[model samples]
Target: MESDEIVRKFYDETVDDEWERLERHRVEFELTKRYLNRYIKPGDKVLDLGGGPGRYSLYLAELGCDVTLADLSEKNIEFALKKANEQGLAIKRLQVDARELSTIEDSQFDYVLCMGPMYHLKSEEDRAKTIRECLKKLKPNGIMFVAFISSYSFVWDYLIRNPELILDSERKSELNKIVDGKDFAGKGFSDNFYISPENVLPFFNQFDLEKLHLLNSESFLYLREPELLRQKPEVINAWLDLAEQVCEREDLLSMAEHIMYIGKKPIKT
Candidate 1:
């Protein structure tokens, strides 16, 4: 797989709409927050890498966690800062790539959120570099939330949104490529790729961290945000409760559009 240099430009162009993503797909944000609340205490230092437009970073900041938000897109960093100020939240900001965060020292943060980098990192070497760098920034026993846009989720997206493309010979061939472990031709999201659910946990095993949870972020709720918004709060809460109950089920991992792999760094021997 190869990378296209569209990450910064694509995110920069869409920075304004970034926060609205959470607004639309409320489950991803809510579940991730629930996990964060369990682990992140007040004054805990956090690194929100590829944390576009300050959604998670701002949430952490508002919780009194010292959040340092970083991203490859300058426009995203600027937007995140502007919103943080609007929310009266204090967030340290940096415009940097996940693969090379040299300015951030090793073992500095209690929590690290590598939220968006995996979606665009095509080369396996780059993916390894990014995770290695991010984990190195985490304090011993600190938590990390590494997210990905699931490859199986993308297949659902095609079935739900663009069914016609699924049957077309040329498009079918391309989709097959992705199913067979290749990157997608970035559609609405420019230069995107997906990782299989089966690969996620094992991918992190190579790191010096104890595996904790692999959450299927929007289980069976993939591309159903519009319907979710129409539900009563109690109804939505009920479904969310069920989602939480079943999120860790390996069978349901691919049903989610987004998934987060949580792990804790080991205390040095």
Candidate 2:
């Protein structure tokens, strides 16, 4: 219940901030959308499990997909509904936990977006349970997009946000603890689980799913200060094209902040 409380309290307090995260992080949003569009069709039924404020759900609905947004925070659901109404997009909402999606019928959704839950599931059992629940709701051969915060995200974050602490030898041990998915001492989101870059694909391979993709959401454009690139339309387009070209490159996967795994549930033989 502590994990649940952490997720609800954090997301509830930052509903508007969460909504703008995608808008501000242009590459993360655009590249993720590109990957989603590649597999999902116009009329697909999409379940955005743990979707905060329904950003993706609203986007999918606008593209003619039937979407249901679910999250642990009642506030997120309310905010998502409000946004959906303002956008004139009709998307269903549910206040549900990712590990327990029993209210949703099994094997109905064409796509399952289990993006946010994995980020906070600190235990292996909770992660696997949530994955099973997502798979249970997914139709055979359905596409599932799961997102992960890279184990080393804090390394980059520290260098950017806390430059002064780098020289502190004491900070090295702190970062090491964070790499193993523990909470950082003083900042950022709490109770988040970080995945090692090398283990991203292999972790999901244990399941009965075909690996479609394992790539960084921001790709090579991450620390390059993408916000500056956004000012030039042509440059942003070309950079996005380059990112999509190399996003799935295996060698470059570890340098990203957010990693996404695209998998397809295999139909029973």
Candidate 3:
């Protein structure tokens, strides 16, 4: 299947429930909120690129940010609009491709939250174009938040959860490709591009953006068995606290299932 079709179908079928089910998803959402609070003020204009179902957009709207959500999936936009109306939150929802935000004027937003596009844009050219477009949409010194699936974490996950894949010749080749920062799309997997921590900065260096921080969205949480990690609320909260403290630790960053790169567009002198 083509990348856009695969992504659209995946979200259309699963956007309603899959994200809320995982412990890691909850951690990612919490960390995202924490970072947004740190950088955004009330009344700021935020562009949430590829924001499925308005998860972050609704939260930002509630916090008084003028939020606009753009996504490729029509079903996602439908769900997002429904949720926004239900919550009595007013937010702009656009069903559009992240790479082609031509309708939005340049330098119009205070912050750009690109949490989903990087995961599926397989080619380096596509990724760079997407990032550049996002930066273009932000005002001078405006912040951009981009997220990626970490290659190391994916490999580690397979080793721990599905070791049989490592033994099978065909599956091993696909796994090796993923470890090499590529992905294979199929019935079980959406088209994705896994990125290594070491390569992330260099990948985005072409743009005139200042690096603010690189964080592991779910650091130590990835190491814990999901069933065990879900047992105690207090323990889980403490673990999340620990994740916040060590999110920027370089040694542990690549081990996270999701990695976030926060950068600011430099103000021209």
Name the top lDDT candidate: 2
Q: Model 3 misses residue 120 by how many Å?
A: 0.8
**For all candidates, what are the clash counts?**
0, 0, 0
Over all chains combined, what TM-score does candidate 1 have? 0.93
> Which residues of candidate 3, in runs, are more than 4 Å off?
18-24, 177-188, 225-232
Off by over 4 Å in 2: 168-170, 177-187
After the best TM-score superposition of candidate 1, give how far the Cα of residue 242 lies from its true spot, in angstroms: 1.1
Q: What does candidate 2's lDDT look like per residue over 92-200, in tens digits?
A: 9888989898999999999999889988887878888998999999999898999988877878788877877767877776577644754332334767877778877
Write the number of the candidate with greater lDDT, choosing between 1 and 3: 1
Model 3, 70-157: lDDT tens per residue? 9988887888889889999999978888888898889999999999898888888888989989988999989999998777655777
Indicate the TM-score of model 3: 0.91
lDDT of prediction 1: 0.83
Ranking by lDDT: 2, 1, 3
Using all chains and alpha carbons, the TM-scores for the candidates as numbered come to: 0.93, 0.93, 0.91
